[model samples]
Target: MRVSRAETTMNYVLLLGFAAFALAPVITILVTAVSAPLGESGGIHLGNFARAWTIGGFGRTLGNSAVVAVIVVTTATALSILAGYAFGTMHFRGATVLFYLFLLGMMIPAEATIIPLFFDLRTLGLTDTYLAIALPQVAQSIAFGTFWLRAQFRALPVSLIEAAALDGAGPLRALVQILVPASRPAIVTMVVLVFMWTWNEFLIALIMAPGGRLRTAPLGLANFQGQYTAETALLAAGAVIVALPTVILFLLLQRHFIRGMLEGVAK
Candidate 1:
């Protein structure tokens, strides 16, 4: 008993250390955001945040980011869950090969695809539009989401699905009422992962939505830095604001994510 107690304490101590390491930079950014003035003032001020907020145009940028993240998360979650079920629970012609092909997108680096995506969007008149950013992110989400959800779906007992079918539940019905509810952890994990990815996504937003007017938070923050020029504190505040949503999302969903990864994948 003493040994077990000692082990648990040590584990917690280690976890706290890891937590600090992860949070240090985030805390630093928060500190910086409130600490200094735009230029020669070099002292703490609340105005830094306000100044960054107004000048950075973060309100519009944050709104744009919120829209994209929400849409991408919902669209990707639904599509990925459906596709994952198809690939995992219901085998169709070319399904295996197609899933692997989707997985191949993971191998191809983002840099390789950005140029082609730009040209394609330019032709389609999607440049500087939310669709321009959202569509590419949707596609990118599939690569990872499919892989993750397929694993979750594949882990379910065949008996559960078969039992539902026997009870007059159609495939769609069973998927919604049975498969999905049973796979809550996996779904939560997928949502969190998708939200975080879409929220933090920088390069695609930068390339696809270059207009300062249409910029997302990260892009807006970058531009804010240039616009303020020497206001490290304000810049840091903007950075913190941009990062907050992702942090809250991860905290909310992290438990389910880890559980799904461990237990859901095992099945």
Candidate 2:
């Protein structure tokens, strides 16, 4: 069962190769962002970012994206924890059926439902608003969150819950004081994923908030691309601006995220 040093070294080298392959495009983009444009050669064009930010209106769009992500992540995580706890611990009639209904949200693509969703939102006068952008993503995140957190909750020992109950703790108290803390990594992983998904989402934001008043960062980046087809450095700079938040978030929470993912696999 033991691995030799040569095997371990080989594994590390293979992993490095795969990592480099994955990072190659990102490296290219970063290099292109700083590189001189097609003409008028000079030092690395750091000014491209300033120009892109101003021209793309990314300041507003980025703030909109942040607002939507916070709303979705907060609502989805809180609801998912409660749903996960109920499904994982307390069994009831129709629980399986209801859980499968939630899973159906994941099975259905946003593309499939976006048109009708837009119509529905418009009918409710919710279109072109922050709620319009945040709500659907909240629903999407909840489906996965329920699936993820339920497993984590179910993995805890039954004795732990019973012990809390014996100590006069109610269901809410037991969950808040013990289970939530214990499942912090999984919860954090879910938060990071939901934030990234909400941030990167383009289609929903495009269709739901079409007035351009509530454009998210990705939406703004798309518009920037259209206007700057000839400007590679500016395009790359806009892309970096759009992608930077998610990258920073992942870097910040990578330890917890990796632990949560490994635990999910193990479970």
- Candidate 1: tens digits of C-alpha lDDT, residues 14-106: 999999999899788878887857345556677777877888888899999999987898888889988898888987789989998989767
Error of 1 at 161 (Å): 0.7
The Cα local distance difference test for each model comes to 0.85, 0.95
Q: Which ten residues in a row have the lowest lDDT in candidate 1?
A: 36-45
TM-score of 2: 0.97
* Cα deviation of 49, candidate 1, in Å: 2.2
My TM-score estimates for the predictions, one after another, are: 0.90, 0.97
Q: Candidate 2 — which pairs collide?
A: none
- Looking at model 2, residue 151 earns an lDDT score of 96
User: By lDDT, who's the top model here?
Assistant: 2
Which predicted model would earn the best TM-score? 2
